[model samples]
Target: MLKQIANLDQNSGNTFKLLTDETGCCGDSITPCKYVAAVPVANSVSAVVVKDRDGNNQTVTFAAAATTVKAIRDALVTAVNSVGYEDDGNVLPGISVETVSTNKVVTIVGELIVVSLTTSGGSVAATATCTEVGICEFYVEWGGGASKVLTVNGVNATLGDLTFATASAANVKSALEGAANWPSGAVATVVKNTDDSIFEITVTNAQSTVAFILDGLRLTRSNCIVDYV
Candidate 1:
């Protein structure tokens, strides 16, 4: 017996029709042998709408059962061509994405200094009486060449006294492993060494050539680094 099966619509916007039938052998004169068979046919169509750089919208249509990946890609190319960036024939630069992980630290070869620092989290006060302070604030600065000001609490200080935090040898080595100040360019995580005294900052950026800057107190930058990629 021949039967019409159900139709299927795929998420890719393709439609398919299914048909089932019984096959008969050569002995039909007396009695026919039957075998089940299934057949499928494509019948769907799709269209793509894209916006050109000039803010114009374009449409590309695909015929029923005739849409190929290559054809769709070509249509997209054409649609994109319909618009230009800045009215200048040149194409606009694609957004840059990247991940960066680095360690920043302020090292004292000798005497300790008092300072005040601010971060996204809060402010930390460092006094000359102490040898070290814990990392508190993590700074994240995005976009190349962008300057940011981080207020540090201090009695009396000058720009020259401003320095990136310095990590001990152990901290420097482990810096990439732990969570640090991750900015917009990337995601960051810091891991502590097995000894637990050292840490590594790891950063991953989705795009290339992106960098992040971390600024804060000694405790803040203890195991963090500026990520540039």
Candidate 2:
């Protein structure tokens, strides 16, 4: 869901960030006090070779001199958007190029891979906590906005579900953690902020016998920018 944290105008004296949901959980809620778009941290990449769903290859090359994070991000976006990146008569579905916090972030919904990497490469890999081989798609929401759908793989056994009232993230976590015969063979854990506004699902024991795939990390919203908050 689309979420926004605001600052009160001292003159206007309007309600501001440190948000609270209808459940009456305020700044103490599980939501982050501040949510800023993620930027590339220090790390270098000589080149990033990406393969599309159609097996078409696109190479994002970083100039040896372009060592800064911004430079690498710019080069990657430019190369991916270059003509002929997509296969003839085909479109890259649900893939978006965006600038967040001055960093380039790609929201990919299908299979993608880095065929090659150099020592300059940073540890860029999937974040889904899946350890099995099937795919599961679900709708997740933060605060009181529309739900965003994400397709996750078996590796990502952990997922978050939110409720406004008597239901708390703890309750959800307890149920999931207590589930029987988890397919991923991993026990799950749920965590929420003290205020219970935000929550996360994770695996107690992480195994990688099978690869995990995630449709995308951020949700699609206005202006083609993936909303992280």
lDDT for each of the candidates?
0.27, 0.37
* Tens-digit lDDT track of model 2 for 1-229: 2122222223223433332232365552322111122225334556555654346765566556244545654554444444222211222232343566645454433223334333244534422211222222222233321222223333334333435344466675554444332434444445554475654545433233222222244321121221221
Query: Which runs in model 1 stand beyond 4 Å of their true positions?
Result: 1-45, 50-57, 63-75, 78-186, 195-197, 206-229
Instruction: Please list the residue runs of candidate 2 whose C-alpha ends up more than 4 Å from where it truly belongs after superposition.
Output: 1-41, 50-60, 64-70, 86-114, 119-172, 181-229
RMSD of candidates 1 onward, in order: 28.0, 19.3
CA shift at 108, candidate 2, in angstroms? Answer: 5.3
Which prediction has the highest TM-score against the true structure?
Answer: 2
Per-residue lDDT tens digits of candidate 1, residues 1-229? 1121222231323243232122243432211111111111111113333332234544444443223334433432332222221111122111111112321121111111113222222332322222122222333322111122223222222222111233333333233222233233344455444354434444443232223333332322334322212
